[model samples]
Target chain A: MTERMQNAADAGPGPHYLALRDHLAGEIAQGALAVGARLPSERQLQLGSGAARGTVREALFQLEAEGLIYRRDRSGWYVSPPPVVYDPTRWAGFMAYVAEQGRVPTTETLGKQSVAASAADAAVFGCAIGTPLFALDRRRAIDGRPVLVERILVDPVIAPDLLDEGLDGSLTAVLTGRYGVRVVRNHVEMRPCALIKDVARALGVASGTPGLLVVRRSFDAGDRIIEYDHEYWRHDAIRVLVEVRTRD
Target chain B: MTERMQNAADAGPGPHYLALRDHLAGEIAQGALAVGARLPSERQLQLGSGAARGTVREALFQLEAEGLIYRRDRSGWYVSPPPVVYDPTRWAGFMAYVAEQGRVPTTETLGKQSVAASAADAAVFGCAIGTPLFALDRRRAIDGRPVLVERILVDPVIAPDLLDEGLDGSLTAVLTGRYGVRVVRNHVEMRPCALIKDVARALGVASGTPGLLVVRRSFDAGDRIIEYDHEYWRHDAIRVLVEVRTRD
Candidate 1:
């Protein structure tokens, strides 16, 4: 072997804190440090790295900066979960995909109310202003982490009793099975949005935290608009996948 | 009219700061506050709203928190541009879309280098590790505001003289015209990501600022993988638009 190769081999993991960082990164990449798994304490890392406490802290800070690990207020550092892949226009429910990936998904209804559609809403839905609409507010979580908060608007005529239907599960399933309105198409738009006001409060994050704002309009088989949804997702919690085929 | 409706109508706007917030929000919604246009100063808003300076500042803070307006350090507040709609898979160029929408689009080549494909990259590209790939770093802007930073990897054999040619302008156009490789399909994935280190530095944003991370793999008509790109977009600058249609 060349002299440089032999020297690198002898040095093995490199500088103190960097070596520790590399070790932790390797573990994360290899799934040894699984998503949502708590990391060792700073003291433990210090011991493992055989570096000074300050050096260990710096390495941890670097990892946090890289988005490989995150810190919660009461909780310590933990391996950041791999982002959940979402297909906004797909007919399948969020629960199905989360479960398919072996992650536990849960939905909770925050509130429900009947409201008069505003002028803007009327324009989008092609209905008169003040048309009665059912608004369902929900918080969705994966593996005990609150990830998304959604406000869904539905045409009351299509699902007259939607407010009382116990919106704790997949609204899509409920719309198909009970209301007989199946979503066959969707127009979806997503942008980065700051989590503010009630949305940040719902997701338990600070106001001004970055979030993905997803707006979707779902159409029934008859081409009637059935639902309008605004979703705010934690920036660190999800990924969206889209496949586009152009030529034959 | 009901007594409550009459009271609201008589009140006109609302409390001092809230009234000011509504007025500004209305202006933004109605496009009176044009994209990239400067917002009125705090002193001007105080004059307009007839509120105290602190109240005016509070209203401005609210608007900034809501992503309707952004401050550029010393440059004062600008009406946050309405998001540019993006379709990651469309094979259309960003320059084309921006120009069509009457916005100026420009690209700057930051740097370029050759990289040896790693094992993971080899698996994704179905190539051997250590194969040469050209890496191009670029920054794209709309209306003179930097919006996206991209790292693009291309197989050297396909576009051998790529580095010799300037890396500015439309990459898709270059590939089609120079290499005779037309993109037929793409696999796209996006997630909320924080702009950090070099990315944040390049975009001139603070570290940990929320952004969109988009990864795409483009394929030619023969299903040959041609390009892999990682893009970081300012969250407030772009929105992804996607349409999905399914049969009954």
Candidate 2:
């Protein structure tokens, strides 16, 4: 049981279990549970709170099912870190997603390559079949939690040198600093989809976990689609708030 | 497996299993799955596919895992129809989501009344805490498959007759038809969320299943926010599509 929960035990029926559960919930709400904190084991909760083992186990089970906690087999239960926040409206990319949400981010650039696109890839990037495209893939994490697998596709005619630049900081920075392209508008489409095999494995979820699919086409100052890309994220990891405004 | 699977079994391995899975997927893709078609049993598929019971079983398992098929304890597996098409962008209310996808719909209103608002409920309707509000709750379906649980909050002054009229077709239709408060614009906020106990039970899924959180505010020709509502859609049950244009 968390310390906060133990404090609540005296006034409640099933005080022991209720106290522990409440305590853990409060800590999580207060952001004090700290990502990856080792939670009390099932047996420890029973002994500390003087509850039946079944009650303690049930409480742990509920938290795990709610995505509030995770277990690593013999490692016991640990608090799940907060989800990554992403805004499709901004062309700021995933690094911004973490920083804007007030979390530190660690980025690993998987690759930056110039490749001829496959038919499916061409269809998405809105380029001719077999056109050269820039593929930049990155894995973004916040508070040590894997959040999104993002792959950006850039049209080579617009930003030929983009493939050579480091993508650790920002895509927008490269477009502006290196290629003199300013992203002015973006068209985004989002849907709920199953995580493909690679994404499931990378995100440490079971295969076929539902995921969010975000496809965005970003425009340059010239009103050209300089970048058209697809990104996937773990569902239930974050909530996307889209405020659609109409002309007055 | 359905009757179609049985007939497909007469075909060779080159086509039987692929054909079986495709046929079912196509039915779903084309919206011809029609909600509650009885799926054949594993034993039945074995007899029909001419493939091993295992092959048919694998296909069934894949579809079930995909939420395209579901089973009742005593009843057989059945097709889960596509989610009723709903969009947060349209001011036409719930019906626009379905009708836009070229599907006909029917509604049975659970209850409708003018309510003196509770603080929480009033905030959703954009009304004062004690102002009269038109509150509606509905059970909506597509092709006989239950797809959405819709709750709407509207200003009572503009929709005084909404409670008197049954809410079967469309909420926006009622507002436009009776009050002349036609929907001219909508502001939508969308997020990925997990179904808690109450929403899960209503949507026929495990509580942990992911959902689409769509909160929308509809505006009339006068640019006033007329109604505020939210909807929860089963992720596996629907696909929302948008045509993305290159920023030209």
Predicted model with the maximum TM-score: 1
The candidate scoring highest on DockQ is 1
CAPRI tier for the interface of model 1: acceptable
User: How do the residues A30-139 of candidate 1 rate in per-residue lDDT, one tens digit apiece?
Assistant: 99999889999988887777889977876675566456787676478889887787886566677899988889999988778776666667887789877777878788
Comparing to the true complex, what docking class would candidate 2 get?
Answer: incorrect
lDDT of 1 by residue, B103-216 (tens): 899999987878667566778778887777787888999888899998888988889889888778988888888889888888898877666556777777766667888889
lDDT of 2 by residue, A1-248 (tens): 11111123222344345556666766776778777798877877778877798778756754654457765546788887766655454445666667888888877787776656655566666777667777777776776677677777788888777767788777777888888887777777676655534566666766555667677777765667777766677764666654444544
Clashing pairs in 2: A5-A19, A5-A23, B1-B40, B6-B48, B9-B49, B83-B237, B85-B97, B86-B97
Scanning candidate 1 chain B in windows of ten residues, the lowest lDDT window is B1-10
Individual DockQ of the candidates? 0.41, 0.19
Candidate 1: pairs in clash: none
Model 2, runs deviating above 4 Å: A1-27, A30-39, A43-85, A112-118, A125-134, A155-162, A181-185, A219-225, A245-248, B1-90, B108-137, B150-165, B169-188, B196-198, B216-230, B239-248
Give DockQ: model 1.
0.41
